[model samples]
Target: MKILIAEYAGFCFGVKRAIETAYYEIEKNSGRKIYMLGEIIHNPQVISDLSKKGVNIIEEEELDKLTEGDKLIIRSHGVSKKLYDFLAKKGIEVIDVTCPFVKKVQDIVYEHYHKGYSIIIVGDRNHPEVRGVNGWCDDTAYVVNSIEEAHKLPKLEKACAVAQTTLIGRYWEDILEVIKLKVKDLVFFNTICDATQKRQGSAEQLSKKVDVMFVIGGKHSSNTQKLKKICEKNCKNTFHIEDAKELTLEMVKDREIIGITAGASTPDYVIEEVIKKIRFLKGEKEEE
Candidate 1:
């Protein structure tokens, strides 16, 4: 049996920055109460590990519980302007770890909305990143994730559109074409992260050459789900799993070639563990 891995597997720069910053803050301020706005990234294992080390996860509703001098670390997904202002008013120390790409989308939405342009976001409406981006425009942006959703939009004279950072590339193109027809004057920004495009491209290429494909990441991660969907189209035997413990002997027994790809939030150690487990299942030695 042979194992092949995607060239761009594991955490992207944004996730790395967020996790590293979170750990640093935790250690640097050992006595102060630390709270994360949400899961630092979407990975449960990463969240759990940090929680064990003393970082507390809280939602928007729980902000009132915080007092002055408390440290609140914003996740990579970011928060709305309203939340930031509220924290500032409460005198809480805010550590913003929002991805630079996500911050760019918020800036574009804020700038375009003030110029009297109707804002539209192409992404999952419920995603935290999309929600935070909408907040910049006061939550009035039209959010759509599919071509059908785009068609359902009312005709507009002028509008500006931006995409969620982790959205699939082909979905963005398909939806953008439909959006162009619905608006007379349209301004669009391709806000999808460059790393996302590379990861999807590599997964697609690797899936085509292997018998079975494994996509690793948190189950709730949007980027991981997109990777699974992309790989599934090319290889029907694709599996989406969080870690090596989810792998079964039956899944690999008859497979001659296996391809592995992970979401941007996945850590390198998790990927290495999966590879090691697969090797063990094949009766290979540690050196091999």
Candidate 2:
């Protein structure tokens, strides 16, 4: 089958940097125990591959129990500064792999919080990145994903708003609009990364022309979920899969135009394999 791919899909700058850093940390700590604070970049395959290389993914609780000499690697989603300091106090080695984009947000939020503005974090409420952002302000920052929350802000005499890099584009705009009206003094930093914006735009554009769309990325990846949501709005035949193995042959048997797009955390080879399987099952001639 002729598969059209999104030009912007896969390994945004931040995720690429994070993954590269993790692998390098693994190599550097050879013959020594290396633990990842969380799945490095949300991709199960990537974490599984790291595990094969002796890198262990540990929970905060388990890591809390680790001895002073143990080494822990932070994921691309930056941890709260409090956690970093705590680890140092415990004499644990820390390898910070937080994305530069995330670090920038933390810096901005820290500055605004100290300046006496109530912080508003725009993103998923439970996402690690969002939680980390909230922790910067002692969890005083308001976390909201919809316009309703923005309108209900008890009061916004002075506020600073920031969005998670992988949020729905329009939702960010909507929240900003409402908050602008209610707050007497407001500042907003569009922290949404370019990679996410491009991917979301490309996914929507492809969905309009394709008969079936497959979104490939880690199940836990926020950006991947956003891409799928964008595609679903434009196409009914949208499927979100981490790998081709998760796709069934029957679903695309009748589809003539297939579109494949992956998330920032998805590797190129995984997308290639899914395209290969789709062509094989559909009995369509593969494009060179």
Candidate 3:
């Protein structure tokens, strides 16, 4: 049996930076109360690790309980402008680790919304990133995750569209095409992160060549779910798993070529663990 991994698998630059910053903040503010706006990233293992280190997840309602001089770590998903204002008014220190790409989308939406253009978001409406982006437009943006949603939108004179960072590329394109027809003047920003595009591309290619594919990441992770969808289209035997334990020996035991890919939030150690587990199950020596 042979094992192949996608060239762009595991945590991307944004996620890696956020995780590193979270750890640094924990150490730097040892005496102060520290809270994360949300899960630092979607990976449970990483969140669990941070929790062990005294990083508690803070929800919107819980924000009021935080006192002045408290530190709130902004997760990579980011929070709305309203949340920022509230934090500032309360004199809370914010350690912002929002992915730069996501920040760009927020800026674009903020700028265009003030220019009399209707804002449209091509992404999951429920995603925290989408919610945060919508906040910039005063929650007036039309959020659509599919071509059908775009079709349902009322005709508009002018609009600006942005996508969730982890959205699938083809879905973004399809939604944009529909939005164009519904609006007289349309401006769309390709806010999908480059890392996301590369990861999806690599996963699709690897899936096509492998007998079995394993997509590793937290089950709730958006990018991980997208990777699983992309892989499933090319390889029917694809499995979406959060960790090595979720995978069983029988799944890949007889497969001649097994492929592994992970979401942007996945840790390198998690990927390595999966690889080692596979190798051990197959009675093969681990790589040095």
In model 2, the runs with Cα more than 4 Å from the true position are: 284-288
* Model 1 C-alpha lDDT per residue in residues 1-288, reported as the tens digit of each score: 989999998899999999999999989999777999888799999999999989999999989999999999999998899888999999999999999999999999999999999999999999999999999999999999999999999999999999999999999999999999999999999999999999999999999999999999999999999999999999999999999999888888889999999999999999999999899888784634
Which segments of candidate 3 are over 4 A away from where they belong?
A: 285-288
List per-candidate RMSD values in Å: 1.3, 2.0, 1.5
Q: Model 3, residue 44: displacement in angstroms?
A: 0.6
Q: Model 1 segments beyond 4 Å from truth?
A: 286-288
Residue pairs with clashing backbones, model 3: none
Q: Per-residue lDDT for 230 in model 1?
A: 98
Residue 264 lDDT (model 3): 95
**What would the C-alpha RMSD of candidate 1 be, to one decimal place?**
1.3
Point out the higher-scoring one by lDDT: 1 or 2: 1
Candidates arranged by lDDT, highest first: 1, 3, 2
Model 2 poorest ten-residue lDDT run: 279-288
Error of 3 at 267 (Å): 0.7
**TM match of model 2 to true structure:** 0.96
Show the lowest summed lDDT stretch of 10 residues, model 1.
279-288
